[model samples]
Target: MPPNPDLRQTIDVAPGLDLAATLGPLRLGVSDPCWRVEASGPWWWATRTPAGPLTVHLVPGAGVVGVEAWGEGVEWLPRHLGRLLGLDADGPPAARTELVRALAQRVPGFRVAGHGRVADAAIDGICRRGVSAFEAARSWLLMVEAMGDDAPGPGGLRLPPAPRRVASCDPYELHVMGLEQGRADEVRRVASHASRLEAGTHDGGAEAIAHLAGIAGIGTDAVEHARAVALGDPDAVPVLDAHRTAAVVRALWTGAGADDTVDVRSLLEPHRPERGLLVRLIALVEAADAADDDGGLTP
Candidate 1:
């Protein structure tokens, strides 16, 4: 395979960036790259970087998968992993709609084109097990640094852990990284089968979700999220997320009680295969609102 590209960049997010407020909803940081959902200028974006301004972009065919970008480092993150950032891997119809629509609205000029690695997606699921986005990201940062490949960049940040690494981690060690005993055990269990998954055993995103649910601590929501990130299951909607659920409620019924729209199955009815798109639309709307709070970008 051809070597990956150099996608690292160095744009600054001006002065009005809010770490917690902007990324409070989704668990972006719960994996190797450590994602942070952000918005800059007219575009609401999500990224993974320790510092610098956010700049989301799309790059095709890097390494064995596509690359996605965000942050100054994106001007320069090796091309291999960068392309995965904006990956819109095939998923259920509903999921595709949600991701596409969300990206269109949030990332302006964004396009879903590229392949992503299954291994990265699996690790992302483990880090996100039953926690807030911040919690997941923090945990992921710790895990990736603790056990991952040496990243080929200035900071020396490690690449995400390999499948065997995840499978081999002892339960005790996992707890140290904030994972409960059961959750830790689940990570190891899933890791053992990571190779099988890496082989592309599952048929569709639904099959992938089913496999994820078979692992411990992973339910429908976790399964869906993992599929989206790992298997590129566009139709996989993270129905279990609080913000997504709340957004769905608001979109369907402006003044309705939150409880009225809590049913994920129903909320996704209209979009069918593109259920995730509805949630993403709501999420973009919310992200855009927050970005507007500071009188838009300084530019």
Candidate 2:
């Protein structure tokens, strides 16, 4: 029987969110086809199927309250999605020191927390490689809706898909999702072994990276990205990509320097052992809607 789709109920969109800016960029401004989110907190959008475009916006501190679905069950949002999307209510220490200070100065909504989402991070990395941000987001929507599990949250909304289910997906299925074979293969490979690597933040930082890197299509940058989802390891520097790199430079040096040629290690040297924390702190501070530009100073 086809799974029922109207099982979600009760979502409290957290107060104090600047929906206009945050939701737009965070959700790639509707660039992703499978999912479309509104600029309202605690709002819900139903999918054509349990696996189709499902969007949920809850209060900053709000959580799941109820759920009801057709095809499969829905409960608990995926940890990985939270990590990549910066949805976790809590924050973690930065990987670099200067990042800690810089973040302390910029990026208001950023937080420091352990890794949250495993599958989303892996799939996002693969699908995004060599593609435009819009293309990657679209591919993600296609891939997840096709293979992901439905978990109920605060309003009975199903969370992103599960790793086990994703691992078993066929390449052709991803093609149906509008994804090419190579990206699909990468997603499968990462999802296949997600369990071994999804070992919570405080526990599996280094090990998870090594394991993720072992998969085909995954590289140093990919592994670091996974670590961010898995452990929220603040130090998981994404030095490979151009956009993130540019963001890093701009956030770090306040310059619109080219990301392609920048060196991650050299840039992060200022923070040393605590670079990750600093970077995230900067992001968090910058994300804040109301800021004095003094970077929250007591002076």
For candidate 1, report its TM-score: 0.61
Worst 10 residues of 1 by lDDT: 58-67
Scored by Cα lDDT, where does model 1 land? 0.48
Residue 29, model 1: lDDT of 37
Error of 2 at 33 (Å): 8.9
**Each candidate: RMSD to true structure?**
9.1, 7.8
RMSD over all Cα atoms, model 1: 9.1
Which residue runs does candidate 2 get wrong by more than 4 Å? 1-99, 107-109, 153-159, 162-165, 172-181, 200-210, 239-241, 251-260, 274-299
Per-residue accuracy of model 2 over 1-299 as CA lDDT, tens digit each: 43444443543333333333233332321444323443443334222221333434333333332323333212323323344234453432333344364544444444444323454566656666666666666677655556554433323333455666777766787767656777677777887876665444465446666677777676565666556534556556532335545556766664475555666567777765555554444444444532455575411
lDDT of 1 by residue, 1-299 (tens): 42233453333231333223223223343243533222332212233332333334322222222233434545423432322333222221223454445444454423222123343455566566667656766777777677765544333235555557777877777788888886677667766765444313234334544565676554455556666554434356643435555566666653444465366577567666655545554665576777688677421
Each prediction's Cα lDDT score? Answer: 0.48, 0.49
Q: lDDT of candidate 2?
A: 0.49
